[model samples]
Target: MDALLSLSNDLAAAVERVRGAVVAVNARPRLPSTGVHWRPGIIVTADHTVRSDEDITIIAPDGRTVAASLVARDPGTDLAVLRVHDTDLPLADLGDPGSLKVGHIVLAVGHGPRVSWGVVSALGGRWRTWRGGEIDQLMRLDLTLYPGFSGGPLVDVKGRVVGINTSGLSRQLELAIPVSTVTRVADELIDKGHVSRGFLGVGLQPARLPEAFRRRLTGASEIGLLVVNVQPDGPAAKAGVLLGDVLVALDGAPVGATEDVQAVVGARRAGSTVTATILRAGAPAEVSMTVGERPSRRR
Candidate 1:
């Protein structure tokens, strides 16, 4: 009984410690999500929750409503940054998400200072989100993300934010974007006003190579991506990649699927270059292709 009481008190104290950094984000029409004061005057929220690019506002912890401007948004990672002025809300005390172990006690600190306790259910290495964002790490939690909690902070026992809670990333599982990823994305968004991803303009489909060709390309996979369409003047076309070329590998990594292509391109910046190994008419060749920025589209 004594242990239970102590634990309860500690959780409540944690909520109190993090309350000031949590704010109510009103960017969507109906449902308002939460936001955290990640840095001074910088609020981070879930990108999906920010339905409007203009006329956005946030309700601070003290019930003071303030106007916020949409700074930049990265839908691939489901994170958005908003800028506020003339507010003195406390910034989040962040902890290392890498230190989290399975079954470690965690808290979701949301707007209105709502709290839900849970454990770190699982951890995974580098992964790409369905929307093509490269996440540094995967942090899953066994907690209920209450309404308006999508952009809240996932706090540790010491009241330090370890991640940002979001329901927008997955349909079946609750996920928290780890602190390292959040900081990296947030910094990029703040600096460039948009996250940049390397792109190669080409339509490709998986094609199984002939046994003889597979043997020739010793380091590549049996299946390679066959170039069906090459955008005119695009990265691939500019690099002298012709149609009917089967891409065997990118930078020595065998790419059997589109995800594999993304894994390589996304890791590199727009101005960087990648080594593309291809089989042109059953003959292996390599092309040095400079990566291009993926053209931004209106959401």
Candidate 2:
């Protein structure tokens, strides 16, 4: 009983520390949501929770309501950055999400300063969404994210923000976009009003290489991305890439998953050429293609 009581006090204190930087975002005609005061005059929330750029109100920690303007938004990561007139807003101490490990205790604080505690259930490496958004890291928690909790902060016991929690992107799991990803995306959104990504115009799925082929490429991965479709006149098609070809590597880096391809393509500028190593008919071949800017609609 003593141990349980001590744990409760620790959690309560952590929540109280984080509550100083938490804000309730009331985008009219939409449900009230939560946001983190990431910096002076800047609030970060879930992009899905923010319906529009106009007529938004921010309920500060002290319960003083003030108007806020939408600075920028990225639907791919489900993050939005809003600007308020108040520079005195308390800022959250951002933690390194990369340091988070499975079983670590985390707290999600939402509107009304509601707190939910849980453990980090899983952590995934870099991956791309079906929409082609490049995520630096994937973190999921075993916590119940209630309504209006979409844009809240997921913090550690030290009261440092681990990430932004959102339920809009995943149906079966509670996902927190890591602080590293959020910082990168938020910076780009603030500077450019949009995020740019590279494209190859090819649909790919995971495929396994035959035993003999895997042995031939001793240092290479056993799995690769199988091209299922190629857009006509697109970069891949223009470079003679075809359907059914298995992409094994990009510019010397192993291409084992869709995320690997995305990471390579996203790192390159449009109009730049990249060497694609593929297995066509059980034989390895190399093809060079110019990277293209990913269409905004696709993003």
Top candidate, metric lDDT: 1
Clashes of each: 0, 0
C-alpha lDDT (0 to 100) for residue 119 of candidate 1: 95
Error of 2 at 220 (Å): 11
Evaluated against the true structure, the overall lDDT of model 1 is: 0.92
Quote the lDDT for 273 in model 1: 87
Count clashing residue pairs in model 2: 0
State the lDDT of candidate 1 residue by residue for 42-106, as single tens digits.
Answer: 99999999999999999999998999999999999999999999889988999988789999999
Q: How high is the CA lDDT of each candidate model?
A: 0.92, 0.87
Q: lDDT at 80 for candidate 2?
A: 91
Per-model TM against the reference: 0.96, 0.78
Residue 180 accuracy (lDDT) in model 1: 89
